[model samples]
Target: MRNLITFFILNLLCQSLTVNADELTVTLLGTGTPIPSIERFGSSTLIEHKGKYFLFDVGRGATIRLSQIGMYPSDIDNIFLTHLHSDHITGFDDFWITGGIWQRANTLNVYGPDGTKSFVEHTQGAFSLDAFYREKQSSLNLKGLEVNVTEIKEGLIYDEDGLKVSAFRVDHGAVEHAYGYRIDSDRHSVLISGDTTYSENLIANSQELDLLIHEVSVIEPKLLQSNPKLKSISKYHTSLQQLHKLVEKVKPQKTVLNHLLLIGSDETELSHLLETKFQDKNIDVGHDLMTIHLR
Candidate 1:
């Protein structure tokens, strides 16, 4: 009887682990460019694991985009900013406003690089007048809502409840200091290369990751012909060929190309080019609202 009880306990523990392992899901919220599009927003990605929601890079329209997917701003437990670029942080104000209006009881945690605290303070200051008026008119006090800002460094930024998140510095040119994030749970890991140029560090850090989501730009002849300035900027971003090489080296289980530039072209050819370079790995082109289950 004692042996049978021990056996059943071990089996139940194994089943619980398996169920928790399959709970991580990544959702691509806004897989578009700085320039607005009818189909896509800017550059936000939502990660859900073990009943917790984390938002990375809340670009323009991210709050509304979340609403479209049946998630409120309050649903986000943590917000990780890759950089302070306008395209990346523009929707932060909207997130603040929506969370305040809804009167969420929980405090929101915002994490980012060096200037994160000042940025949040400035944003809060900008909303001060509006917050005052809302407080006067309604039962909810907007200004009373807490927004905790933590300035992050290189190593592990967050670790709790079997989930660990780390940040690595990435090259995004002189505009701002940028970072790529890696999130690891017990059974799966994901890497997000947030608007970076091709970096050896990212490739090394992302090796054997379950999912690698990196930005990609197109350098086809027609794009170069249309806009010379855009062509120059594309050099600072990751090109299809560069991404192909990175995938070849890191060899992640799946490679997702996102933050697409020069889209509406032959995406299949681009995927095929990447696949030929990194054989035996799944290559996917990201679209807004696309969800991938991480097992």
Candidate 2:
């Protein structure tokens, strides 16, 4: 009788663990650079767990990419913008349009750096003519679509339902203030290094995180020589070597590379270089619609 009771208790514990593990799902909807690439889309990630959906960035074609993965703009619970880069936010209008057209009941909560509120307001105003025309032509009510924008500095932005999100400023060239987000749930935590070069803040915030989704841009001397414009732009991005050092410090369980540009000649070389540098960690290059089931 005692043995049977112990066995049942262990079984119950295992089942509970399984249920918790199965609830969290993350998908990279688009994983490309500013320059168009046939194989990759722009930078956008969708994180869903326990009926909650969070979008990290709305790069170009984010709506279409999300739809490709069987997710609608209506499914998003929150939209977090890392910065105001054109590549990261060009799809904001699309997301707004789709949400309104679909008649989504939930208001879109957009969080970002200091200038976010005004940026959103400007985008909304730019669409005013279209919104007015649509309302007059079709019976669709455009005024009801609410876009709640919150400009964040640092510290806790959201905490609810066993999930906590913290944002911290990161170093990204002249992009006045950029942010890196740390998302903690009951079971796991992930850090998103949104378009940062290299920062001690990001390293400290991301320590021991389960996953570190960081951007990688190849800025080797040879590559830079070929494209002078890239040299100027690469200052704001993280190189493969720099990323390797970041992984070494944070020592995350997994490092998923997004916003890749000029990843050397071949994918294997980039992967090899990263692996040789960070021997203990697993590195993954992100692709559009790639789903990762977190444990």
Task: Kindly list the per-residue Cα lDDT of model 2 for residues 164-244, writing each as its tens digit.
Answer: 889998989999879988988877888888998878889878866788889888756787889877787888888877887
Of the candidates shown, which would achieve the greatest lDDT relative to the real structure? 1
Native-structure RMSD, model 2: 2.6
RMSD in angstroms, candidate 1?
Answer: 2.8
CA displacement after TM-score superposition, residue 293 of candidate 2 (Å): 1.7
Clashing pairs in 1: none
Query: What are the models' TM-scores?
Result: 0.89, 0.90
For residue 200, what is the lDDT in candidate 1? Answer: 83
Write down the worst ten-residue block by lDDT for model 2: 261-270
Candidate 1, superposed: residue stretches over 4 Å from native = 1-17, 222-228, 263-279
Question: How well does candidate 2 score on lDDT at residue 57?
Answer: 84
